[model samples]
Structure formats: C-alpha cells, structure tokens
Target: MNRDSIFISHATPQDNEFSIWLTSRLEMLGYKVWIDKEGLLGGERFWVTIQQAIQSSAKVLFVYSKNIVTNEGILKQGIENEIEYAKSIALQFHIQDYIIPLHIDDSPYNLAIGLPNINHIPFNNNWAEGLKILKKKLEKDSIPQIFDTSKSVMAEWYENEYISNCSIIPKTELFYTSWWSVSDLPKEFYMYQFSNEVQAKAIRNSNQTIPVSLMSNVLSTFDAKLSFVVNRDDENIELKPVHTYIYSLNDILYGFESDKFPQHRDVENHFKRLLYRVVSNFLIYKGLWRNEMSNKRLAYFLPKYEKIKKIDFTYPYSNRKKSKSILGKFESIGMWHYAVSIQPMLFPFVGFSLKSHILFTSDGFKIIDDDKKQHSYRRKKGKRFFNEEWRDLLLAFLQRLKDDNEEIKIKVSQEGLVMKMKEWPEMFWSEVGYNDPNSKMDLDKIEDYYEEITEESND
Candidate 1:
C-alpha cells in the first residue's frame, strides 16, 4: 500500500459537492485522492478501513464548515471521530502539517474544535482562487504525483459518475434579460452654446433639471428647449441660447463630423453619457428617489410612498407559477428596496441595460448609510434570490414605470421627441437541457423568508 494518496475528510451530503470538485481537480493533477462518497456507515470494519486510509495518506484535507459543527460550538460525531483519528496518526508519524483545513463557508475558525491553531485555505468567496493557493501549498510540500496513469483513471471515473447524471436533451428555453430595448428615439441632437463659461458651468451644475453633456461653453442635449429656468446668485438670469450645431442621431451612432469629437468611439461614448443622464432624469421625473453610490454613479430606488407599497409580478417556479412583490420589508434586515444603475449600450443592442441593486432602509424612507453593514446585509439576504427571482424583480420594477398607455416613454427634446421602451426583450434558445437543482431549493427558502416578513409586517 502506497502512502502517497491524499485523503479527503468532509461532512457527508452537505459538503459532497465541494469534495467531489476538489477530488476531480486533484486527480487530474496526478495526485491519488481517496474520498468516501457514500458517507460513514458507522461499523467496526468501516472505521478500520478509514483509520488505515488516513494513517497511510500523505496529507488529510479537512472540509470545514457549519455543517460539521453546530452554531452552539458542538462538533458532528462522525467528523470528530475522523479528525481525532487523523490527529493521532499525525502525532505518531511526526507529520508537521497533516491536516489542511479548507474553509468553505462563514463558519468561525475558533469553533472548529478538533483542528485548533491550524491555518485554513479560504474558499468562501471564490473557489478557483482558493484552489490556486491550495495547489501551491501542495507543490511546496512535495506531494507525489503519478501523472501518467492517474489522468486516465480520473477521466473514466468522471464520465461514469458525473456525466451520467447530466443528459443532453433538446428543449427550448426562454431567457429573461435585464436589457430593455429602445424601440423609438429622437432623431435630432442639439448643442446649446452659452454666452460665457460661467453660464455653461451653472447649466452643467444643475444637470438634474435638464440633462446635458457640457463641453467648454457648449451644452449638448437631445432636448430642443430647456425644461427648467436658469438662475444664478439667487436671482433669475435671462439667458439666450445660441444653437451651435444640430447633429443627427445617425452621425452620433455611426460617425462624428465635428472636430471636437473626431473619433467614432468618442462620439458613441458621449452619446452614452448623455443618455445615462437622460434616463436618470426620467426616473427622477417618475418619482423614483436617487441615491449616489460611493463610485459617484447614481442609482434610482423605489420609495415606499403611500401609493406604492409593493410592485407585484408573476414568475415561473418549479412546475407551477407564483407571484411576489419585488419590494418588501425583511425583519432580519430592514427594507429591501430595488435600485437600478441604468447604462446605455449600443453595440449588442440599442437599449438601456439595468443593473439591479438593493438599497436598505429602516422605515422605508431614509436609506442606510453604513456601507459595511449594508454589504453584509445584502450578502446575507440577497443570496436567497435565484435567477428567476432577480429577473422577475427587474421585470416588476420596469412594469411599474409604465404609463396607462402601456409604454415607458422618456421625453428627450422640447420638439415632442421621446424614447420609448415597450417591454423587456425575451431571448429564446433551443436545445437547452441543464437545470440547477440548488435554484429550486433557494426559491423555496426565499418564499418562506417572504412569508415570515409578511407576517411580521402584519403584526
């Protein structure tokens, strides 16, 4: 029997996914790895086999998580037995670093009783990054590898066990995207040349009123006339607007003939910046409150006003359909308000790409300013949302913005020009067969969380 094999000790079923993934990767690297996939049966013969395997192993990789221990600092019986046996073997053999702990979740290291004062490789945030560090440590420890024969064995095992579970079947699937297509847009682009730099600076400063892209003394916009009056020094200033140039949308999309913006990319970038401001202004006009992120980018969030408590929408779940509110109050973490950072895209499609964000508020009025706490709350609560949930949340938010005419229209110019988005674009793909088992589990948990919150709000 060879002592070159790497022994993997993990909590069964709960840590099986990570254990399997790690085993496959290590085996591919030509390291002989042993893992009991069926879990401990708790017999004398089983214990004897496990003890012999651990004793003859080069290093024992322990998968550490809350699954192997309780929140009250109690260790799992099977995991405790395995760790105790491995530690005894390490002491007898004088193995300096016998057990290498792989911390997969947010389980505190202090509570990991069996493996005390040992450094752990963090795989909580990113598995690939953790694997890189683990590989380097293995190489440093001079772990023996039988690359020639091990590769073939791993391929056969993977194909027989893993690939058997997945099947390639022909099916058509509809993918809901965050992209909302711009069906109609204004044709004309106006450049309002101010009298002096002072007037231009004032107009630039008050961008929320009339969205514009300022360059020197020139103010570029899609609107023919300014929506708000210009004032300076607490006095109304009568200013005359001199039209510099009226460029067509085609010129901005294709090429720019102007000397200032010579490059086509620069023209497109300028248009995108101006378009973002327009969309932000449109959201503000629609009564959505704006909150500026630390990066100086503005994110508009739905406020809990008297009229709007929750935005209702329907989404597919399991074999049936379900409806839920995109905005709600979670008892564990304040109010979860749906926020979006709209970015105007041109290459793939002429549309506004909405990036979803969650803003927290105590009473659904004032936003939580503690950045650290907000991040932690988002990680804890937002993890429950599956792809379907996120998609429907975005859909509901967009649906709420629609008028009675069933159109989301933004006024661009004073010349009655507007940009319209009828609805979200649904992309369909054929021959899709894969489905995530975890998503269904997550959806169930999230639904329960929603029910709990609803009950709390009622109380």
Candidate 2:
C-alpha cells in the first residue's frame, strides 16, 4: 500500500484494452500503477480491497466512459460506489485533485458522475496526445516515481502475466512472406560508353526507361541496345554508345568468381539498386502513384481511377470467411490507398520484399502533402486493424498487381529482356502453439457495445 501509487478505476471487460494500455504506459514512466486485474484472490471481498487501495493511493484515475452510465445517465452501482468512496477518502485526507478523469470515448461530461466539475483528459480522438497532456499533469502534481526498480518489475510482470502459456508443437504451417521471388532475368549485362563526359553526365542525371547504374563516362545496364534521348531546355541530347561488355547474370545473382570487374559487394549493391529502379518504373508504368515518405523512402500507391479504385479479397474472420475491400473512400476520412515500399534481397534467396503503407487523399485524387498530418491520420485509422486484417490487405493488394497471371513480368528493354517473378515467396516452418486468452472474445460484441454507448451519449 504505497501512498505514492496511482489506482485505476475502470469498468471490467468494456474498458479493459484502454486500462491496460494506460497502465503499461504509466508503469514504463516509473509510476507505480495499481489496476484491479489479477490482484484479488478467489472469494476475496472486491469492494473492501478497492476501498483499502483508494485510501492508500495518492491519486485515482477514473476511466470515464459510457460503460459506467446507463441510458438515464445514472452511474452503475459498482463504479458509483467506488467514486463516492474515493471522494470521501479525499475529503478525509484533504487531498487536492485526488481523482483524475480520463475521457476515452465520446461520453458527455454533463452525464458523468463525480467528474463534471473536474478537468478531464481527452483521449477520444488521439491516445498519444492524451498521454502527453497526462504526463504534464502528473509532473505538475509531483507524483513520486521509483526510477530504478519500476522498469524491471514491469518487464517481469509482462513476461509472467501479460503473455499466455506456450509450447512448441511438431506441426507444419505455411508462412506467407512479403518477398516476391525472381524467376527470370537476362543473361548478359552491358556497359555502354558515351562519346563525351558531358553526354554521359546528362544520361546519368536524366530518368531512363531501362534500369541502369551509372559511372563517369560509362553506364551499366542489362539491356544491350539501351538508348534514350535526354531533353535539356531546347536541345535533345542522345548519348553515343562507344563500348560494350558481356557480363553474366549468374555472377550477379549468384556470387561472382572473377576479379576483372568491381568488388563483388559493390557489384551486388549496384545490381540491387538497378532492381529497385526496375520495380519503381514498372509500378509507375502500371499507373500507381508514388509518394516519398518522411524518411525519404519512396512508396507506390494505387490511384483512385475507376479501373483500380477498390481491391476485393476474402480473409478469415472469426471462424468463417469474410470479404472486404482493401482500399476505398470513407466519408469520415476521405480515401485510403494501399501503398508499398520495396527492397530487393539477394541472400538465401533472390527476391524483392514489399513493405505495406497507407496513403490518404481528400477527394480520392490528390494526396495529402503534410507528412505529420499523414502520419497522425494513418496511426488513428490503423489502430483498430487486427493482425488478420493487415495480412489480408497486403495479400489483396498483391493479387491486384498480379491480375490473373501467376507471375508479374517487367520488360527491361525492347530486345526481349524481361524480369519475371512469382506473386509471393513460399515458406514453411514447424509451428509453435499458444493458448490465446482473447481467441474466444467476440469483437463484434465490443463494437456493438461501443456503438450503443455512442448513440446513447448523443441522445
């Protein structure tokens, strides 16, 4: 019974997720948080324990939500009892601002019991923003923090109680990878020499249809007859092909044994860059819009054109199959487009992995340009997505790219040079089993409860 401890009062099951999240965050910041979860033993008196905890705690965090009130705006018996008891304790101890209300939903302040007069922290729209304000308030109150042992205690609790029991099982399971396996490529790599340094520099600086890695006075490409006209101001400049070389694709895919060219590591790096360019160009050719992220990485997104507005796919939900669109327009937040960033991998397997991203547009055409706003909106929109939802979204986007074919082919040049890859890489592993505590929980019930509460509050 530490006097500095913060006690959390929340409705069971309904507000469980938010309570756990808030508790974990406070504990990580070295604040001792007491939540009524796995605390009382069987047959123990719950109200008696709660009263004792409130008496000893410095502050009580009341998670004010619609769950704590009925349709008549009357407080539930259990929470009403707890809040009344906490108020009495505060008066007896002469504690100022003893109770802090964390408004996690759209519940009206006027309908809230023992919270109308008090300042409530907002978390309905943004949890992270609410956390920042809460932290400032906690600091102002000079809440005692046990910096040394708090982190270790939190880690121990997470391992022992947070995660469920698990055991390794001798069963095979198919693991889907983001990687797309490369199946075919051109055999020869050519080094094209230009007539002059200026022409070579112009070709290197300009965007080309074929994938290439450039050096001073030389350009390395897989296409033997790679030729492009560079437009500069009022002049059209064509780089002269003065020299050529025969380089093996196997040496690039598999490790090279020859010391005649650059270092194998350098060659591998250059080839990877070329492959990335190929993918980028191919996506652009397929009418996907590109946007650069805050970290300078380029991500390609499906545009809002009628041909590919929404990608439909089926996924496992509950114990049954469910169909949904991967990308579409929402009235609340405009259009959400499925985007992906790619990285070409050469070790263990020759493949390119696609990392998924979500991009937003106001009218389903022009993308929102502000990076900070984009990031915040993305976080808010994606927070409710389950693991299966994210996986299916990525899979659906990949299927859209593959169309009806088993492979996606990118033409490297007009000389019939093409790079072909499978839709997805095949992977398998021995599965480990775990008893998920939330496996039987009904998500639909939770959603319905939230919706009901919101409607009641609005009324």
Error of 2 at 96 (Å): 1.3
Global lDDT of model 1:
0.71
lDDT by residue (tens digit), candidate 1, 33-55? 87774462222337777888897
Compute the lDDT of residue 361 as modeled in candidate 1.
84
lDDT per residue as tens, model 2, 1-459? 458888898877677767767776677667788777653211333778788888878889999899888767788787888889989988987889999999988778976555899999988766666776787788788988764544555446555654534334456544566777778878776666677767776765664656676666667677776655788798887766676655676777667666764557656766777788787888888778888887788988877777444454443222544454656875466788778888888866777877888889887778888776687667656666655566677776665666465458888876768888666454545475333244222121233434443353356
Stretch of 10 with least lDDT, candidate 1? 439-448
| 198 Cα displacement, candidate 2 (Å) | 5.2
